[model samples]
Target: MKKIIELKQVYKDYPLAGISQTVLHDINFEVVPGEFVAIVGPSGNGKSTLLNLLTGIDHPSSGQVIVNGAALQNLSNERLSLWRGANLGIVFQFFQLLPSLNLLQNVMLPMDFLGKLSKTQRRQQAMQLLERVGLADACHRLPSQVSGGQQQRAAIARALANDPPLIVADEPTGNLDAATADDVFDLFAHLRDQGKTLVMVTHNETLAAAASRKLEIRCGRIHADTPAVAG
Candidate 1:
């Protein structure tokens, strides 16, 4: 199978008061299908910047980011948004659920945006995803009505609504307590077992070590890329 993600000589620079600040330097990365990869680094060391590039939330200053067979640098913002809705599942550190929408509605939003399924089909699939995340009973509750863990679970359900091949999470369990974080991490492991390509940016070393591979960043560069010691 083709690589699920590829980045060649990627550099990301931002203008700060008329000076270009480089956040990523000559980053060459690739992820094969079904691999669970963790990116860990110090604060402000470009971990999240790399994730943004992978998700096409931001573009690199030079070089290429090809994910799921599409060169992100070549796509316009409008096209990138559509492609992301169909090909990538993203989980944020803070659950970005629509407070006005219930859990089920939040999960259905992606399918709604993609519009490849009917209303009935979307609802059914959303419920199935909520069930998978152990949140089916709470599907009718609004995000504010749920606990932090539950909100994150609903967010995961929303992420999977489109059944995208790749899932990119930025500190998915960062805000939860130890027990709750473990629960969320378990769900990610289950998804990995089911053959989703996952790239997670995390500060939890324990969780990072459990992934199939680990990439460490330092000083705007990849410091290490090694097979993790499976926990």
Candidate 2:
């Protein structure tokens, strides 16, 4: 496995009542290609803050963040967006599909923005991804028309639009039933087997434990980092 994401002595601070409060402290972490890493912690432990840094949605106040070999601190905002669009696939908890677009259109939107493929090619690629996620027949349906699990599956396919090596999922199964969440996790596992790195922030201990690597956070610090076996 090749190292694809790294954080060095990272810290995040936010202003509260005119005083700075650190939400993440001296974080040091790395994720290599194809590993499924679950970040688990209690509420208000900065799990989401860490995810933001990883995805370049938020920058660390101090220290370095490197993803896919580029130092994030150095990229201009425009460059960062370009880099993210090209290299990282981000999945969110709410299945952030455009409500007006059909599943196939939603999946193709990323590729369309990246403009790496022709119009017809984008449609074909998105169709293939939807098919892989078991949503070929649902492609024409709006996000509102599909079941929660199917919508999540479509979101995963959209994340794969650019065929990125690293995937960051923020509470991807937080809103689903147990069986439905299991189906989503199975898809994630399959993506892992296909050599796509996954960093997931999850509160579900059962789901987190199933990941190949687990990082436990407490009080904005790493409480434990360990390997785990998941069924």
Candidate 3:
């Protein structure tokens, strides 16, 4: 399999009270194309920080973040932004849908920013994605009008709008009830089945077990990385 993402000797630090506090230490990992990997740990173990580094939303303090053979550290901010827009799909714990935009509009926003397709083409593609996520009937509804599950489905649709091969989801099902979380995870499994690479940070062990591989991050390092065992 082709390597889609690689991190070597990575480190991240933040300033606290005029002192540097390291958050991630010497992290090393690689994600192959079409792999579904779950990252789990207690809160503040640098899981979200790691995802931000992979997506190029934030740079590593040291070492490298290579995606698709290009060094993210070397890319200019504008170029990195463009690369992220084209290649990285991100889903957050909270559905980051625009309140002013309906479902269709929210899905179309990425295409608009990327400008890779015409307006009509973007709308058509967004509608298809919404349909795929089982939100076809909710396309015209505002995010507030939908249930939490429906809104999350819409967010997933939006994330897949560009047909990005790599998706980074941080606590995607965190806000939902058990039934809704199950449904959302089913959608994630469907995406994996379609050959998309998924790197998710999750607190739910059930959801983590659904992934092909699991990694435990603790104290800014990977304490374990292994395949999931069937129960």
Put down candidate 2 lDDT per residue, 76-178, tens digits, no spaces.
Answer: 8999999999999999999999999999999999899899899999999999999999999999999999999999999999999999988999999999999
Tens-place lDDT per residue, model 1, 29-97, is: 899999999999899999999999998899999999999999999999999999999999999999999
User: For this target, which candidate reaches the highest TM-score against the unseen true structure?
Assistant: 1
Evaluation by TM-score, superior candidate among 1 and 3:
1
Worst 10 residues of 3 by lDDT: 222-231
Clashes of 3: 0
Instruction: List model 3 lDDT by residue over 89-139, tens digit each.
Output: 999989999999999999999899999899999999999999988999889
Q: Give per-residue lDDT, candidate 1, residue 158.
A: 90
Model 1: weakest 10-residue lDDT segment is: 203-212
Ranking by TM-score: 1, 3, 2
Judged by lDDT, which candidate is best? 1
Score candidate 3 by lDDT: 0.92
RMSD (CA, angstroms), candidate 3: 1.0
lDDT of 3 at 207: 79
Better of 1 and 2 by TM-score: 1
lDDT of each: 0.94, 0.92, 0.92
Pairs that collide in candidate 3 are none
Q: Kindly provide the TM-score of model 1 when superposed on the true structure, using C-alpha atoms.
A: 0.98
How large is the C-alpha RMSD of every model relative to the true structure? 0.8, 1.2, 1.0
